[model samples]
Target: MTDSPEEPNPYTAGLEHKPQRDDTFYYTTVVFLVEGTLFRVPRHPFIDGSDVFRQMFQLPVPDGVEADGCSDGRPLRLEFIQQNDFKQLLKVLFPHHSQPQKSSPKTFAEWRSVLKLSSMWEFESVKKLAVDHIGTMQIDPIDKIGLARDYDVQEWLVPALNELAKRKEPIGMKDADKLGMELALKVAAVRESVMSSYSGYPLQIGERQAGHIDFTNAIETMLTTLENS
Candidate 1:
């Protein structure tokens, strides 16, 4: 009889067995726990848009190590972020064409959440988008100043502060609280000086509205003086 074929090498045989494909697509799935709810989102947007997520994914996975839900075919869990905030961020990062109306956040609160989360996560593009939306919105001047300062949108600062300075009434306690005492005092003083100087006489329709022009000029002058001084 022909010599029995050499016993198949058991280790090599095991190595030769190819594992069945689980899925055709090679996308990573991440799970987030937000306010007791679980969010299963694709990892691509996070990896591409956020430096925080990029570095997290780059960490080495130890042999045989398993994460909850991950072993049971669920995404790996990410915790600590608020659900509403994460949802708002997802709306910006992965807008769906089917819901064109909801593709981008329209309200100030939603964009504020987006800005907060995107900024925290270092999602530069999403942060920029949030900033753009917030800049164009009809937010209260004092609130706009706060947002501009928080987001480093310097272009919004002077215009928002100028609007506050031009208001006929004194800045309210609530608004002053938001603006803080020093800036609030400066605005109050500028408004007082502008009204006293600009309101003594009425002008023709052809002439510049003195209150408007003078207040605008005075605000600019005050800001310039402050900068120079």
Candidate 2:
């Protein structure tokens, strides 16, 4: 007698996707593997927040090829990404994203993680949120310069460098180390030139300008020179 035929498994090891888990209209989750960690979270947040993810999810799977993010055995791999950063991103997307602005308990470092990932993924809204949250922070000028450059925060460049050049507290060894040799040197040069130009008779500069030493033009010139060089 002929033996009975076996039923096909819909979960994995298939050439084509056959709707295994979370195939509903609204409730779907994508599995991601990031630096040896596994995260299974809501798929909609990614689709809504990032065009990259939306485009990826929209790509049609070719015949005879397996799709990723299907189950625990197979997950979408996030290369060159820190698991910690992914965790921080998930903290906001999972259930806390709908809450009020700046409501999450994330620290500065965690927000930075969000910034890094969001920037990389082209999550414009999420990136803006990270930037806004960091705006309220009390980071120092030197550190702000570094953060500004790292994150493409153009709004922070002028204020941070101006503070660095105008502040009475001389740039110390620790400050130099923080700003790096080249930037520290530029800041020192600007301060010295400004001090020399207005020695003895201080310029009124302006009423609202107050005690400021007028580092705007000098900083801009220095920045131009730095850029050209």
Candidate 3:
């Protein structure tokens, strides 16, 4: 047996060659307690992906006081967080490297959760991934508007607004509640303007309003102006 080929990546062979720290390969495990559940994961993702985590990690530990994530007794306690949401985030941040697709978030709600947490924690990469995934699917326009506002999803904003402006149905009470009084009134105003202009006829789905394609641009400009106000 050709002596089991050097088991794996060998370390610096000679003593004279002092071992150097490899930043590229460094990893530390951290434990977090979410909703009374313990989750131990590689610390690098948290430290690297989120400004919040990076700042938390950089804070110096007091003499003789163990870091919160160092042990079970003092694991980082994340508050106001749903354990399922945290788990969904972990599925993105700490995937099953060997079988990545196995741990991939597939459902629309799953991606939304990832987007929410990633945005909240300032994980730009994960946030982008969530945004892209959501882009591929259809979402309720009112909900999308709320998401765009809460997460600063600039691209989703105009498109969702355009959908709302161009759709046939008037905003319902529940949807109006979601959109808030100001925006609901603005949308109603837009629908009224378009309908009244079209000789008492409602705009059909996928039809250019009054045979003018500039309707979306008009809606976007109006909404942007209102939002900024």
lDDT of 3 by residue, 1-229 (tens): 5566554335755567667778878678899999999998889999889998999999999999999999888899999999989988998987875266658788989999999999999999999999999988888888899999899999998778778776666677887789888888777676666543345665543343433323575677777889699
Clashes of each: 0, 0, 0
Which scores better on TM-score, 2 or 3? 3
lDDT of 1: 0.73
Candidate 2 per-residue lDDT, tens place, 1-229, comes to 9989978866665657665464456577789999888888878889989989999999999897767887778899999999888877777666455355544536889888988888888888888888899888987888778888887888888878987776766667888887877878887777765643255665442222324465878888888888899
Q: Of the candidates shown, which would achieve the greatest TM-score relative to the real structure?
A: 3
List the candidates' TM-scores in order.
0.70, 0.73, 0.81
Model 3: residue 147 alpha-carbon error in angstroms: 0.8
Cα error, residue 46 of model 3, in Å, equals 1.2
Identify the runs in model 2 with alpha carbons over 4 angstroms from their true place. 1-25, 97-105, 172-178, 196-200, 203-211
Compare candidates 1 and 2 on TM-score and give the better one. 2
The deviation in Å at residue 211 for candidate 3 is 11
**Candidate 1 — which pairs collide?**
none
